[model samples]
Target: MNEFPRMSVRDTFARDWYLFRLDLLLAGMPNKKVAEIRKDLRIELAQAAQDGEFRQALAGLGPVNVLASNYLEAHGRKVPRVWAGLVAFAVLLYGWLLGVISLIEGLYSAADQIRPDATVEVVRNWLFVQARVVAGPEGVDSIGFSLSGWGLLGWLAVLVIVPLICASVWRAWLPRPTADQAQRA
Candidate 1:
């Protein structure tokens, strides 16, 4: 009997995790073809596992991004990385919010320092949002925050940052060059 040694649970887990991530990154691929490729990969992985080279085999396949790109290119499909784009959008939105908050806080603190209890109005009116930090002799009396409209900077941000994000997502969407091609470039 020529029985191959079974892989340890850790090794099995490592292989399974890699394949699972590969499966996720292979989105936009034809289900049947994707299944076929995954099946074939499993067979190859099984052989490598018997030799206790499971991790190395997984690494040899390359990063999930490049591997997915290769498969996608072979199938003649250029699928946009929708998930990544969405994530980027979310991060930008939240980051901008944080920036606005910090700006308002700093302005208020500065005013408080210059005129501790004096009547002061710190208004930062942007294209769409208008923020007013008012302080009376008794310190900060009221905080006024409103969404007026998209300011010039807001439009500029949309124009500049948005295209850059799209270009980035698209660039990431496109197939990556092989190591040799990259070296040459």
Candidate 2:
């Protein structure tokens, strides 16, 4: 039998971390492979624990642990096909929400153009009528608000900038692995 290489504290922690993610990826795979990988990782973790290094390494990996836990909880029960379908459904739902909001705004604008006395009730009724035509019985009365040109521009800016900010924050939180670390995995 081939013996695995002895791993230092840091190396062991990194290995275990990667293996945990791998296990999640392979959750629905064969039990034999999962057990084998878990056994190996436990052995490494045990050795690191004997030297008090496992706790230290785990302290440094708090963020990674949180991320991994969230990922597994969100995705573990889902196969790739189901995961993709769920994502598509979410996207479609979001688009529909935006379309409905846009349509309501458009109706309010149209009502304002036609009836100078475009009270909130007029906009609400107009939206309800148009929504009934498009969305049938599912349509409900919605509150509406108007945006000034600057306010609309500000909203647009937020829509574009929020994702960029989130991407930057994510990149900062998880630094790129060094070349050697990448190769080790």
Candidate 3:
């Protein structure tokens, strides 16, 4: 009375690989939707295996990313893309760093106006920007500035950069441009 469904090593491997890639592509999707997808995929894999067209079935489904995107779009979900977000974050952070370096340099140049005897010196590299404003003859009343305030960058990441990248890359809030619209631009 021991009856279990059987699958060959090749079928098992193919099924596992397909599911694994699908899982990765569908990460951050809602759990209910994921479960539904898993169930559907399992049934589809079994049918494909029974028909001896498992590989063709997988191929017909197309790339996992595209399949996942279709599934998500079918469900009306707008998921943020990790690669797009990362690229946006990197570019924004670099810009912020440049701005910080420039501000530090400006402050250093204007140090003399803050105090008659103030002297400015760069104490750290541009990437991890830092400077000191010595306002007294013997290093007294010294002021320091650095890339210490990450809140601006953090806010940009959360509020502006990531969202813009997601929207633009995925066309989340915009309809796909028609061929005529593209030609006009």
Q: Whose lDDT is greatest here?
A: 1
Off by over 4 Å in 1: 1-6, 113-185
> Per-residue CA lDDT of candidate 2, range 1-185, in tens?
53444567676667677666666555433456457656765676666666768766445445644544443344332232223434444564476467767777676555444443223344332211233112212232344445446655664565455555554454355445567644432
Residue pairs in clash, model 3: none
Q: Tens digit of lDDT per residue, candidate 3, span 6-105? A: 6689888888888888887775566677888888888887788777787888788898889988876665544635546556767766786677667655
Residue 121, model 3, lDDT: 51
Candidate with top TM-score is: 1
Taking all chains together, each candidate's TM-score versus the true structure is 0.54, 0.38, 0.46
Q: How many angstroms is residue 112 displaced in model 1 relative to the true structure, after the best TM-score fit?
A: 2.4
**lDDT (tens digit, per residue) of candidate 1 on 116-144:** 55687888864355778888766776676
lDDT (CA) per prediction: 0.72, 0.50, 0.64
For candidate 2, what is the TM-score?
Answer: 0.38
RMSD of each candidate? 7.9, 14.5, 9.4
Better of 1 and 2 by TM-score: 1
TM-score, cand. 1 vs. native: 0.54
